[model samples]
Each structure stands twice: as C-alpha cells, then as structure tokens.
Target: MKIKLLRAATAGLFGIVLATAAHAQKSGGVLRVYHNDNPPSASLHEEVTIATLMPFMALFNNLVIYDQTAKQNTDSTIVPDLAESWSWSPDNTVVTFKLRDGVKWHDGKPFTSADVKCTWDTVTGKRDSGWRKNPRKEWYSNLKDVTVQGDRQVSFHLGRPQPSFLGFLAAGFSAVYPCHVPGRDMRTKPIGTGPFKLASFKSNQSISLVRNPDYWKKGRPYLDAIEWRMVPNRATRVLAFSVGEFDLTFSQDISSRLAADIKAKAPQAICELAQFNIQTQLLVNPIAPFDDPRIKKAMMLAIDRKAFVDILSEGQFRIGGVMEAPPEGVWGIGPEQLADVPGFTGDVSKNREEARTILTELGYGPDKPLKIKVLTRNLPIYREPAVLLIDQLKQINIEGELEAVESSVWYNRLLRKDYNVATNSGGSALDDPDVMFYEAYACGSERNYTNYCDKDMQARFDEQSSTIDPVKRKALVNKIDHDLQAAGVRPSIMHQRGNTCWYPYVHGVSPPQNSHYNNWRFEDVWLDK
Candidate 1:
C-alpha cells in the first residue's frame, strides 16, 4: 500500500472502499451536533477559534490533513486530501502539489491550483480588504510565494526549508476554497469541496449542512446531513445530550465535573478521554511591576500547579509549561531536565516560601499587600481556575481581585494587552515545538498575549527553524524552553484532559489526540440506528 491516494483513481480505490464498507456499513443518517458559541464568520481561516472550528471543520477540506486513523498520542502523520499528491524540490525550499481532479466546489466550480494559491496568499496576508485578521500568519512566516503550475498543479516557494510545512497546511484552518470566491462571500455562505455543503447558517440559531453528492471521493459523507445548533448553556446542552437530542457533546468542550454527571445520567453513552496540548496559564503581562523579572519569579513560585490537577481534573492530567514537559508530551524536556527549570519542581512549600521572600524584597508583605485585578473568562472552567489562582496569590500576600469577562471579549482584551494579570487557556492543533514557540512566544507575534519579545529567544527560534537535524533542533528547543520558564511570561497551571461523550449509536469516530476539536473524523462516521 504505497500511500497511493493520489493515484487511487487508477489503482483500485473503489475496490478498497467497497471492501471496507462491507463491515455492516449502511449510510444515510443526519448527525445532530452542538456548539456552544455562534461564530461571527463561518470560515475557519478567518478565525481559528474552537467555537467556529467545532462546527465548520466537517464542511471543508484542506490541502493535506492529519491521518485521523493513526492511533497515537499525537498524530503528526499527514495524508493527501484536496491535493492528490506532492513532491519537494532538491533544496527543500520548493514544494509542489498535484490537485485532485474532478473535485468541484459546492457552487460547481472546479477545484484547482488557483484555490490553493489564493487561500495561502490570503492567510499569509497578501490580501488586505477581505481578511478579518491573520492571527496565524506566522504559520506561513517562511512561505515566500505560491505559484500555479498548471490547472491541477501548484508550487510553494519557501524563503527557507520548513520541516513542518506540510503539517501547517494540514491544520483545520488551512481548508481550500474557490479562488474566485471573495473571503467575505465565503464566510457568508461557506462553500468548499468537502463532503458536506452548507445549506443554511443563522446567527445564534443553527447551521444546516447537506451531504455533497458531487464529492470527489465516492460513497463518503455517510451521513445524509448535519445539523449544528448552538446551546449556550452547558447544563441544557448536557440535558439534551442525555435525552438523546444531540448526538455528542461538542468535542473537548465539556468539563470533567459535567462529564461525570453526564456519565451518571447516560451511562449507555461512550466517553472517550483525550489528552490534548490545552493548558491553562496565568499570563504575566508585560506592564509595570510584571515587567520586573523579580515579580514574575515571585508569581511563578507562588502558584501550585498540582493542586489545579488534583482539584479540577481529579489528578487525571499532567502539569507542564511552554512546550510539553515529558513522557506525556513530545519533544519537551524530560523530568530530569525539567527539574532544572524554574517552577517545574514538585516542592510547592519551598517554592512558595521563596515567593514570599521575593515579595517581601519588593517592599510588601501581609501588612501592605500588593492588590491586583485578575481577569478571567466568564465560564465555569475558566472562573474555577481563576478562583484557585486568587487563593494561591493570597498566600503570597498578593491581594487578587477576580473579574470575569465574556468569552468574546476575553481574547481581545488579552490581545490588546489591556489587563495586568489574566488566566487564559490556549492550545495548538499540532504538538510541534516550532508552532508553539513562534506563535505564542516569538517576538512581535500578535498571539503573544503577554507582550513578551525576547530577541535572544527569537534568534534561537530562527536557528531551530533552519536546523535540518532533529537532534540539533531538539537541543535548541530545550534551551529556548528553559529561557521561557525563567522569563515566566505565562506560568503553566495544568494541562487539561477532555472526555467527550457520544451515544453508542454514533459509530466510527476516532477521538482527537491533539487539542483541536475539529480533528473529529466525521467522514468515516455513520449511525448504527
């Protein structure tokens, strides 16, 4: 099986599918899913928020996509989708893709190389008026140019060789669209060559999608249709799920406490646990006292990460910082190495004592405490953690005030550096170090909410990016990780493990190992009932 998807047309592809379908596979059921938030735009590229990606992932196809079939903690394996196959030039700076022929957009436009070029150009900030914001443009920071080779072929000229370039394209945000479709128009109606086509989308109501009969891959989209509704209240959503109104809880969005309750209510439902890269961190803002390295050290030492795991997840998750920190994570510093990093050790009492000393050195203790407002999302998951953070800060004589903001405004406030201290949750679809470092920690990164801009770390990022050898790159990444912990731009709280529940009747879903809820493989899903 030489990964023959590109040439599957001539290579007995139908035979394989038919053989697989023989295993009690009967299609035609509408999957009723739920997402909590109604998105401002239907396009995945426009906003990489989980609220949007949760529903629209099934409605679009990327150039290359993760092999959802891969059974691993992190499935970095890439497989062809919109692009039939691809090859790289000798220098590794130029990569070319062969588009899948006969694929048509929902609007009946032929899927071609132009679509690939246009999508990349827009994401890389080549277009101005149409794009809402290119938050993840750093994903293509090395991309020099995109050229259409022919009707079905395209080439990407890179300024430098990107080891994980294909992985970037495989991300859910990189889905392809008709080149002629304006960004605003695509977000309005939402059109793609995916298995399902958007039939209707209403703000804060419902999103209806019907199976695309013209899908290039035959016999796919087993579901006749998909109905996505917004249920703002998690309690109501879980109630509906227990009574069999919705098929599954939106992947990884439900809290562990709620998951236990859901399991008690619907014991018949299957609960799948996935450990993603999502981590809650107290972002040490770059404003004033936080800009002082000593204050950052004090804050980092004061918080107890294990308590967060013990309380929130019932000790079911790992505690880590920056890149993931060991056996549970990938390419990160192992425990022995991690012990050297600040705030990673398990001696909580000792760390807190040191934190008190540092706070006292800054000329304040319990008598004259340092009072600050801590901003958090107005959601149960975030608010609970923020409360814990306040308690932890109180131990160090830091009088903390909690302010909960709506989810919509929470991120914008962080992006604008509006808050002095905020507890935020963030995750990457890929566990790749390059993706984490550049987007969240690099200099001038819009996504760097803490406003951390270390030129030394930035230079190291470039070195690791250009380094061809994995061993050398790993060394650079470790050094960078150590520096990040020292800086305490964001103090790691705990990595979250999400338990997504689905009815036994809903079959063929492989839970995503990565943090992305969009990685749910709906194309292979079919209802047993």
Candidate 2:
C-alpha cells in the first residue's frame, strides 16, 4: 500500500490502541530483512553489493573504518575490529598497522598481516583472484608496495602520498578479506571473522547467516541469525513488513504519506527518510558534436531542474552541482557557484538558441543533425529525467534518442565507456570529499568513464590527495570541482535522498552518509523486548 500523510496518522492512532505484536521484539532472535535486489553475481566483485559476501570486514578487519554512529571521524589510531593500533610515517606515504592477537577466521585459521597484504594485492590486481571478488580495481591502482612487519603488523607504502587513503580504508568497498581462500569458489563456501557466518543462500530467494560460536566480540550479536530475502516488489515488501513477515524493508516507491501512516499506526516502527550520497546526472561523452563547450552549455540550459526534482524526485531531491548530496555540510562546496554558469539559467528558449548558435557556428544543420543516443535505465526516477532531457534537447534542435538498457548491460557499457550520453549514480558512505574527487574526477581513476582527461585537474587532484592540511585540501578540492564543472563531462541534475522505512526495534542501523540507506552494522543492534 502507498504511504500517505493521512494514512500515516491513522496507522499511528490505531497502533497506539493495539500493538501486542510489538512485543515480539526481544533479544536472541533472527532479524528478517527484505533486500529489494536479487543476490548479486556469485563474485562479490561488484562495488555496490559487497556487504553480503562471507566476511569482507565483519569477520575479518580493516586498518581503519568509518564509525557506525557518526558519519565523520574515521578512527585510524586503533583497530576497531581486527587490528589493535597503527602508525603512519612523516610523509604519510607509509602506514604500519598492528593486528590484534588470537583472532580466528570462521574456518579456524589465524588472522595475520599476510592476509592484509594479500587482500590489498588481490583487489589491486597485484595477485591472483581469490574466493571473494575484487570490487576496488578502479580505486586501488596506486599501491606501490605492502610489507608484513611481523605476524601481527603490516605496512603499506604508496608510490605517492594519498591523504584520503586512510578514509577510504574505512569504507566497506575497501573492506579487508581472507587471503588464504580462493575468490573463484568463495561465494558458496565463504568464511570470515564476522559475528555471523553465511549458512545458506538460495538463489533468487534468500540468504541466511548464523551467529559464529567463536565470535571475537564476547556475548555480542545477540541475535541467533539473520535472513536476507530478495524481494524487489515494493508493495509486496511493504505488505510483508506490515504483516511482520519481514522485520525491515525500504523502498523508494513507497510514499511519504504511507510512511507517516505506519509511524502513526505502528509507533513501534519508525519511518526514516534521508538524503543519499549520490548524484543522478547526465554524463556526456567527449566525441565530436558534444565536444563543443557551447553545445554543452545550451543543453544544460534546456531542462528545468526544478521540474525534474518535483516530478522525478518528488521535490525530495536537491538540484546539485559538481558536489553530491547529503552535502557533508562541512566538507562540501556550496551550490551557489553553479548559479553563475552561462547556461545555468532556467529559461528554456534561451538555452535552445544558445545551443543552436553554438552548433551552427560549429557547422551543423537540419540535414546534419547532432543525432546521438541518450542511454538510460528502467529505474522509475530515470524515466522522467530522460524524457525531460529529450524534450528539452529537441527545443535546441539536438536530436537525442533515449535507449533504456538493463542495468547489468548499462553498467558494463559504462565501464567500457561505450555510450554517447548516459545517466547514473555513484555512492560513497564516508561522505568525505575525497570519495567524490578521487572516484569521479581523478585521471585514470576507474570511475572516470568519460575519458575526461585534463592534465591541470589531474595535477591538482594529485597535489590535493597528498596534502594533510584541511584548509589547503578543501581549496584544492574547490579547484577540482570548478574544473570538472567547466569541463561539463558529467553534469548533475540532483543529489538523491534515501526514502526508507524500518521497525523501531531495528535500532543501531547506521545509515551510510554516502551509500545505500540500509547499510548498517548489525553487531550492536538488539530487538527491544
């Protein structure tokens, strides 16, 4: 059922009157969560869905990690889960980490620095593939070398200093893995140091995880187990949640009204909606017609961002510039700068004329149309935006066609940098500026699919990554953002906000500042009895 404000009130009122069902929440119970997507490929190689794999970090550990509660403050001085403590060199190029003693993988193997070196080497393509897939091939191409100082400690020496490396280490994408296990077959017979071990996974159905008897954290992960079900149908998932068949489910399609109703009716459950760390934007290739700065500007001016935000994002999304949303208020560069760009105007005809003038100046006519394919996906939000862009482009006489491809095919095409124009999103949970800069802007960085090579920007990005001072670093980031926006390779329409709902009993669910809303550490969470 769709959520409405009125319905939410009624739900809340009714919930106050009768909710013996709420009592079911208690310690030592299995938390049934409905994941809206199918089980990812057997390999955990996809950066988007590595959390479900055996133990990237839950059982194993990382040198550093983002805190569960607070979004900022990546603690590197001490090993929160696996390592005990670490030290960095004066240049910040070399990092030495001391591992915790007596930790055992689910398979009963001792954890050591060798595993750390192997994990980094595997993901960075320095070694052969392992049981778990390597998702950070694009992000971790900078490691010069790694050393095992001893059984308990390891050190990573970078070819160049990377200030953001420590923060990247905290994220799940850069999670630590088991080196001894092979990646090819690890998906089925996975093992990790996490509180829960993968028990069984039924393709297209559900995956079950059981608590590890020898969990490192004493008497933790109070729940006996967790079952993650693949249920993409929004209405069905909500029905399951309402009926208590599923303890948690979050969907973008669910209305805010229905969320309020659930809050009113079942106070035991809370509806939370927040901005996601993502930018759904149109990326233009640098090929011929689009290569002209004037054409890009005209195209930018053609569409009304406010309308797209209203129709596609339900007015919940924020019109954005180079920087992404969940703005990371402190670290983010304000959006005010975009207002001054030549085509940043909201006027439609002005933009069209501008585009026409530019195209004509560059030698183009009705006979020689700037015909190109604007690829999109089946996502509901993408449909309206695609239509809006196509309609807007026609005004400027740019004949753009929309091609909707399967997400799998689309992503593959993106990685190959095959499309002329496309719309997509990238997420980072740490909310650090480096997540945006390094992943999206840095030259030769895997995420830079547009082949947008700018020597000046690359030089600045390199300089910025090595700077330890915050003020100087932000200034450098400002330059990078400005240059990227001016290049117009990827222009953002909006930064998406996460729309989700969950039971109140599902406490300690730490939403990522930049990734999926459902990303949470299940360790300290306990159902109220």
Best by lDDT: 1
- Candidate 1 per-residue lDDT, tens place, 66-102, comes to 7655544342356778776777777778878877788
After superposition, candidate 2 runs with Cα above 4 Å error = 1-26, 42-46, 49-60, 71-79, 130-135, 187-189, 251-268, 288-294, 326-329, 342-349, 359-371, 381-384, 399-401, 512-519
Which candidate has the top score in TM-score?
A: 1
Candidate 1 clash figure, as a count:
0
User: What are the runs in model 1 whose C-alpha is more than 4 Å off?
Assistant: 1-23, 73-76, 255-257, 334-336
Consecutive 10-residue window with the lowest summed lDDT within model 2: 1-10
**What RMSD, rounded to one decimal, does every model reach?**
3.1, 9.0
lDDT of 2 at 15: 32
TM-score of each: 0.92, 0.84
Cα lDDT of all candidates, in order? 0.77, 0.62
Q: Global CA lDDT of candidate 1, please?
A: 0.77
